[model samples]
Target: MIKYYYPDGSHCYRALHTAHAVFRNEAGALIARAEKPDGSALYEFEITGFELVVAGERCT
Candidate 1:
């Protein structure tokens, strides 16, 4: 599972790891994805006018 959060919105997805494995260690400032609630195969990938909100991954 993976949850990509944007400034204005957020996404909770159940990724097919065998096909598209999104590793947290390799995701840099992004959240360390684990199992989450209300997940689906449906996903959206866009950061045009949004900012990624990660916890403790940045020095704010």
Candidate 2:
């Protein structure tokens, strides 16, 4: 699973699969692109102020 956390260690968002990529938009919003664990469809999440964690490990 994928998890996002705030700088203060609060939970931000969670998803089933790892993110394919993450980047900031022209508007400076943090975004994550990923597919659902079931492989149903792709999705994008706006996850500003959140750090990424894949499985049980933190992602740089």
Candidate 3:
């Protein structure tokens, strides 16, 4: 699982990592792509104020 948070340390989103990956969009928004491991897109999220956290480590 991946946890997304705001800059102020508030909870934003939690995404299941079952064959899924997260990345940025063209506009620099955080996106959760669950289609395939190759990063084929399915869902897009506007994460303007969110930061990526994985395994208790901050990724972005």
For this target, which candidate reaches the highest lDDT against the unseen true structure?
2
* Candidate 2 per-residue C-alpha lDDT over 1-60 given as tens digits, one digit per residue, 9 for 90 to 100: 466644455665555545687778898877778777678887886664444454455653
From the highest TM-score down, the ranking of the candidates is 2, 3, 1
Output the TM-score of candidate 2.
0.55
Clashes of 2: 0
Model 3 local distance difference test score: 0.52
State residue 37's C-alpha deviation in candidate 3, in Å: 19
Candidate with top TM-score is 2
What order do candidates take by lDDT, descending?
A: 2, 3, 1
The CA lDDT at 56 in model 3 is: 58
Deviating ranges (above 4 Å) for candidate 2:
6-17, 50-60
Winner on lDDT between 1 and 3 is 3
TM-score list, all predictions = 0.24, 0.55, 0.42
lDDT of 3 by residue, 1-60 (tens): 555554455654555653255677787766654443455655544443333455455666
lDDT of 1 by residue, 11-58 (tens): 433343412322323444333333333544533333212212343232
